[model samples]
Every structure is written in C-alpha cells, then in structure tokens.
Target chain A: MNEVLLPGVGLRYEFDTAEGNRIGIVARRDGRFEVVDYDRRDPDRSRLLLRLTEEEADAVAEILGAPRIAERFADLTREVPGLSAGQVEVAADSRYVDRPLGETRARTRTGASIVAIVRGEAVIASPSPVEVLRAKDVLVVIGTPDGIAGVDRIIHAP
Target chain B: MHTSVALLLELGLILTALSALGALARRFALTPVPLYLLAGLALGEGGIAPVPAADEFVEIGAAIGVVLLLLTLGLEFSLGEFAASARRHVRSAVVDLVLNATPGAVVGWLVGLSPLGVLALAGATWVSSSGIIARLLTDLGRLGNRETPAVLSVLVLEDFAMAAYLPLLTVLAAGGSWWQAGLGVLLAVGAVAVAFVASRRWGHQIGRLLSHPEPEQLMLRVLGTTLVVAGLAELVGASAAVGAFLVGLTLTGVVADRARAVLAPLRDLFAATFFLAIGFAVDVRALLPLLPAAIALAAVTAGTKVLTGAYAASLDGVGRWGRLRAGTALIPRGEFSIVILGLAAVADPTLGALVTAYVLVLAITGPVLARLVRAPLPARSGPNVRVDRR
Candidate 1:
C-alpha cells in the first residue's frame, strides 16, 4: 500500500487488488473516506466516490483482505501453508522483547511468521521486519505445528 | 413566582419529550430541526399548553444555543482558506448572491415586508445549511466529486456573507437609524478584520491560554469568553453570535480541536433547545396561512440553488451530470437559515411561522432531491456503473 498526502484534499491510500483493480481510499479532514475505484478505460468510471467512515473503511478493508485484520489472516494462511494459527503472548522475560522483527530469526529458522502485533486494543497488522516487538505484545503467528513450536521456544528462550 | 422544583420538573419533561421526538426523526432518516420546531409550536405561547415554569430558562438556553452554533461554524472555517477560496471563485459567489439571496428579498417585497424584513428574508435564503450539506455529501457519497470543491466554495462564500449580514440584520432589528446601521456594519466588518488578523497571528497563543490541561477548566474558560464577547456585542447593538463566532475564529489549531471536543456536547444540547425554542415562539394557527407561500418560496429557492450549483460546477468544467449533482446538493437550508429567521422572528413574530414552514419543507426536500439527481444516468450515456468488490 502506498499513501500520499493530497495537501488541501485528504490523505490518499492507493493499492492494487489481486484482481488488478486499482483502488484509492481518500481520508478527508472530516473523518470521511472516499473509496474511489479507478476504471482502466473510462475516466468517468474512475471518478465515482463511495464514501465511508473510519469504521466503515476498516470493515471494508477487512472484507477486501487488506488493512489490519485481513492482512493478518492472509499472512497466517500464506506463511503456514494452512496448518496452525495461534496468538503467542510475549512474556516479560522473553528474548524477543524489545527486539525488532528483523533481528529475530523466527521466520528464517523456524519458518513461522508474525502476522500481527496486538498490544491492548490496538493491532499493528503485517508489521514490517523493522517493527520492534515489545513485552506483553500478543503476536499472531502462523506456521506448521513444528514451526509454531519453534517460534514459541525461540521467543521464550532465556 | 414559580418554584424551582416545578421549573426543574418542567425542564425534565420537555427534554425527555424532545429526546423521544429526536429519536423519531432519526428513525426516519430526517433532521430533528422540523421535529424540534413542531415540538416548540405545540408547547409555546399559543400552543395547547404553554410551558410556564421553565419558559424563561428555555429562552436563555435558546440564546446560548445560537451563540454556540455560530461559534462552532466559525471554528470550522479558517479566514486564510476563506480568503483564498473567495479569490479563486468570485464568479460563483456573485452567482450565488444573485440566484439565492434575491429570491428571499423578492419574496419579502411581494409579501409587503419592511426593508429590514426584506434583508432578513434575503439572509435566510442566501445560505444553504453547511451542516446539512456536509452530511448529505457524505451520505450520497459525493464528497469525492470534482464539483465538491465548487460546492464547498459556494458554501464558504455564503458563510462569509452571513458573518457580515448577521450584524446588519441585528442592527436593523434593533431599530437603529440609517447612520447607526451604517456604523453597525462598519463595526461588524472591523471586528471581523481584527479577529482574522489576530487569529492568524496569535490564535495559537490564545488557544493555548484557553486550552487548559483539565477539560473542565478549558470548557469553562472557552464558554466564559464566548458569553462575555457575545454580551458585549449585544450591548453594542451587533449580533451576539457574530462576536462568539469571531472568538471561535480566533482560536485555531490544537485549541480549536480541543474546543470542539469539549464544547460539542454543550453545543448540541443548546442548539436543540434553540430549534425547540423557535417552535415554541410560533403560533400554530399562523402556520396554516404561510404554508402555501412557504412551499412556493421553497420550490423557487430549490430551483435557484440547483441553478447556482450547476453554474458553479459548470465554471469548474464539470460535466452535465456533475453539474446537476452540484445543483441538487445545495437545495437544503438548515441551521443558518433557521438562525437568520430566529433572529428576525424576535422582532417580527409572523416571520417565525413562515420560516418554520419553509425550513421544514426544504429540509425534507433537499436531501431527497440530492439523492434522486445523483442516481445513475442512462447505461451508455455515461460510465455511472460503480464497481463494488464483495
């Protein structure tokens, strides 16, 4: 996903779907999002505005397999090859605490993926490798049964 | 002498009843303005049972509501942005002035109102309700349209016009002499100018001063300053709401944001009361005589607004359908229209019934028309098909 500030207009978040439809979600200053679908051929077709609120946009994003919720589910299914999906809470004593996801060899060694980092009510979906994992962070991981066990052991390792 | 207990009870009853009516309005996807007006009419001076205990308090509440309404409206707009927009779209402003404001003035003349009444009526019709239009735009999903900027520019012009027009109306209603009215206008402009400069320069500082760490303190300070300024403006024979609006414009950035969060609930409460108070001021029987004229004026103004919008959008090079969308979107007049009439009605009671009738008809009609106009065009004529992925 690519986001751009439109200056006076709003924030435009543009992305291409798997089906190759170019979509843009323009979040206006007034907390409204205009979901514009760019038609490949017609300028008029691309000009339509399907407006939504933040919550509505979030729900739509989930349905579209994008944003926080859907991205996590997709990451889990993709990384695990359809085996195990579980939330492993990062205990205060865990070695992964205060470590960036890139520094953790959980993915390269264990073949497991951290789909999302849930801290309290806020969920950071599809966190980049540079994203630091904190204590008490609930990591939504995906892998085969052995890969899942490996992620737990590697994180909890003293 | 009314007992405090009786006053409290009456206030409670009125509010509860109003809440129920508000719920009913929301259920039907309509504005509560009409409902509030109807409730006011039913409980006012000539209604079935006039409210005796809390009448005075309701009146005070209504006044505060108007102040808050104008304040919040001012807060939403920045003078810098308004100046830029005004410069960019002078033609739209002129067209809007001619198409929208003229009808109310003409209607006033036809009805044999005094000069003040004509001005009052003109102000009432000149501005479409920003609150209503913003909601309609979002609901109809037209916020992303190319013509939306054009539509918004027209609205901004209307608001700026109202800031000046309100004081003129206030001076007129105060029965000032010609020279006095001239002076009033000058002072009004001066006040706005000074506020604009001050806000642009020192708005953040003022906002910081008002924006206390505690929400309670911040709310009190903001409310206190607004009331004081409003009172002073009233003392000088200008619109009090204008003063409050200036105060609002002076507080920008973080303070403005905090003010909105702190004052919105209070604004909503009093604003609702103001609408209800408008209804209460009206005599139900008088509404019957004005219904025909109100409907006629609404029909005329609706056309004029559409014309204004379409022309504005056309100037922006938007296509015919987009022009139509722009026109239809500007039809509904809500808060500001009511505020104008509310001020005028204080001097001339007859105007209340007329305005209430007019606002009600358009409030319902505007959204429906906007919705209908934006419906898909013919299959081949335009690419109106929306691609929604499941």
Candidate 2:
C-alpha cells in the first residue's frame, strides 16, 4: 500500500490487488471518504468509484468485518426444531415503506421478532418500535418458518 | 448597558448581504472572498454606504479573524506531512517563491513602494490561496490525480514558510530595523522548532490539558489560550498570527480534531469579517486607479505560479498536460495574501488597494483557468503518462 499525505485535505491510501487493479481511498478531514480506481489508460488519474459519509464508512466497515454475524444466528437456529432466521427485504413498493417498524406489527401478527434491521451498510440491532423502516431495508426475522413467512406477508401486504 | 440599534441593524444587513454573495459565488463555483471584498468596498467610506457604528466591531473582529485563521491553519499542521513535503518539494517551494514573488517585488519597486511594501507585496503574490485551491481540486474531482500531491506539498511548504516569514514582516511592518526584523525571524523560527519538539514529546499531556468533553468547554479552552498566546506574540513583535499558529501546532491527535470541529464555524465567521475589514480599510477610488497595475501583476504572477506548479509536478514525473493542470491549479491567491496585505497596509496606503485588486483578479480567474485546462484535455489520454526526466 502506498500512503500519500494530502496536507490540509487528508490522507490517501492506494494499493494494488492481486487482480492488478489499483484502488485508492481518500479519507478527507471532514469525515468524508472517496474511493477511486486508477484508470488503466492514465495511471495518474482515477475513476471515482463512490463517495461515503463518515456514518456510511462506518457501516461499510461493519458489513465488511461482520459477514459471519448472520451465520452465527443461523448456527443458533440449527439447535432448535422448526426455528430459523430469515432476512425479509423491505421492497420499494412495500406498503410499510417509510412507516415506523411498529406499524408492521410483525411480532403481534406473525409471532416473529425482528432481531435487527439492515439499511444500506448499517445494521440497527434490536430496533425500537419507533425505528422508521425505509425502502430496501432487510429485517432479520427470528421465528418458526411459518411465522417468518407470516411477517413477510404482513410487510408486503397492500 | 446601552446598546446601539444602528450597529445591530448595519451588522445584520452586512451579514445578509455576505450570505447572498456567498451563495452566488458558490453557484458559479467561485470563492466568496473577492465578493466579500467588493461588499466591504461598498460598505467603506466614499463608496456607497458606510457603517460607522459597526466599524469598531469589524476592526476587532478582523483581528480575531486573523488569529482564528492562523490558529486553524496551525491546527491543520502535521509534522509528518510537513517533513514529507519539505523533503520532496524543497526545490519546488524555492522555485515557487522565486518565480511568483519576483513580479510583486518588481512591481512594488517600479511603483516606488517602500522597502517594506516591496517585501509585503512580494509575499502577497507568492503565497497561493490554499483554501481556495484545495476546495477547487476536491470540487473538480482532481484529488485522485497524479499531480495533486505535488500541488498539496507546495501549499503545505508555503504555509510553513509563513511561520518564519510573517514574524519578519511583522517586525519590519512595525517600523523595526533590519537587525530587529532578523532577530524576530530567528526568534519565530526557534519558537516553531520548539513547538514541533514539544508537540512530539509532550503532545498528549498538552492535549489533555486543553481537552474537555463538552464542546463549549473545549472551545473556550482553545480560543482563550490562542488569544492570550497571540496577544503575547504581538507584544514581542513576532505577530499574533504566528503565535496563534504555534498554539495550533502544539495540539495534536483527538484534541486537535475536536478543537477544529468546534472552532470551524467561529473561524469562518471571523475570517469573513477579516476579509470585509480589508475591503473597508481601502478607499474604493484608490482601488480603481490601481486596477491596471494589479491586472498586469496578476498576469505575471499567475504565469509564475503555473511554472512553479509545472516544475513541482515534473519532479513527480508527471507529463506535460498533467504539469499544466498542476501549474494552473496553484494560481489562485486568496486569504493569506489578504492577511499579508492587512499586516503591511499601514506601510503604504496604496498597498491595500493594489493587493486587494490583485487578489480579487487572480482569486476569481485562477480556478476558472484550472477548470478551463481540464475541459479540452480529458484525463485519460494525453498528458497523464509518467515521464522519467532524470
């Protein structure tokens, strides 16, 4: 990895993957991060991959670091009979989009508990009743298979 | 407790006008610095409207603005980065100083300015606006470019140079003799060295002393310490700005980061007021007469900045177009130039008008030129290739 100092801006770290692609990450002073790939044609210039805010960077770190989190839950579910952990994605067209998590009444209607909510790179563990559910959120539902199916039905219902 | 309604009304109106101007500048991808100066001109004597009531406040605010500016500048300093840049770009910095400062010095001599005025003008032209250029690079998505480190290193070295240069200028501006000015420079340089050593050795202890969990407490601690230090610096003729910068340099790690976050808004407000005060101090009539000279000086110095940038980029082995981009990127002269002028404005009355006009021209045109350089040459093909010039 090549670490470059940008002075008043921030530090930039660049490295080449085994695949021969050079990746650069510019960590700004204002808690913003920019990821870019070196253009093959112009080794000096880079193509911007994405810009991430501090929170988004944190969420990205979490996602990349905690890939085994769900698998751990899956292992726990294996010990019980007829119990499973399922992820229910909140589609854009879901009726409960932008509504509070309580509005889904997943626990009351389906006897399933939402263990967590994953929005983008962020995971909200043990989300409160007032936690708003946005489009494309994946709710980690823990319950029997039928109950998990029932919660999904309630979330997607018109 | 008597309050002046006129002061309140005038200040409110001025801030509103500044905000409107700032928005307009941002819309066009320009810095609001020149606009703020224009507003200051209008608000100054014999322009359009004069705010006598707010004059005292602006004056004091302007002083604080310089302190805050240097303080934050110091806060941004990292010993590691400075060492790296200095090692790589010492030649570039020397080239930058020579190529750029010469025009302003020559123009100053031609215009028959005092020896001190010549020195100040030279500095005003030499130091590119790091604030404006940094933002420009980010906005134009050139941070990831090959020549960027070269550009940034030059800026860092220039800012570090100011720590030494400012004290010398301050002593001279204060009507001190050459020996006194030389001593002041030595004193300031020694102080800077001491600051670096102290920051490295006792940084955490110093950080702990100033660090407070509450934002308000932290702000108070840092600002109070900086102001006191700045005042003492001014007393010794080292210049308050340098003192504030030293204070900034001493802080490191989390304390510096939090201090920066808390003080940013205050710095912005005061820094804008400082710019306004520079405009207010100058006579608009004087400014018009100096426009031609300012333009000519801008033209010469702008070319020099490009040459300096190209040379620096070349050191990094960047090809022709990339070098051009680097050179043009370093063109804009902003706050620091104004700060230099503000320091020496008293030496020559016309100095204010000339520097203001010069900064206004380059500050507006520099970014535009950099952007223009990018339009014709897309980064992929022509000049992005590394050329080993050994």
DockQ of 1: 0.07
- Candidate 2 per-residue lDDT over residues B85-159, each given as its tens digit: 999999999999999999999999999899999999999999999999998988877787789999999999999
Candidate achieving the largest lDDT: 2
Best by DockQ: 2
Which candidate's TM-score is highest? 2
Worst 10 residues of 1 chain B by lDDT: B381-390
Report the C-alpha displacement of residue B389, candidate 2, in angstroms: 35
Q: What is the number of residue pairs that collide in model 2?
A: 0
Cα lDDT tens digits for candidate 1, A102-136: 88788999898887888744788889999998866
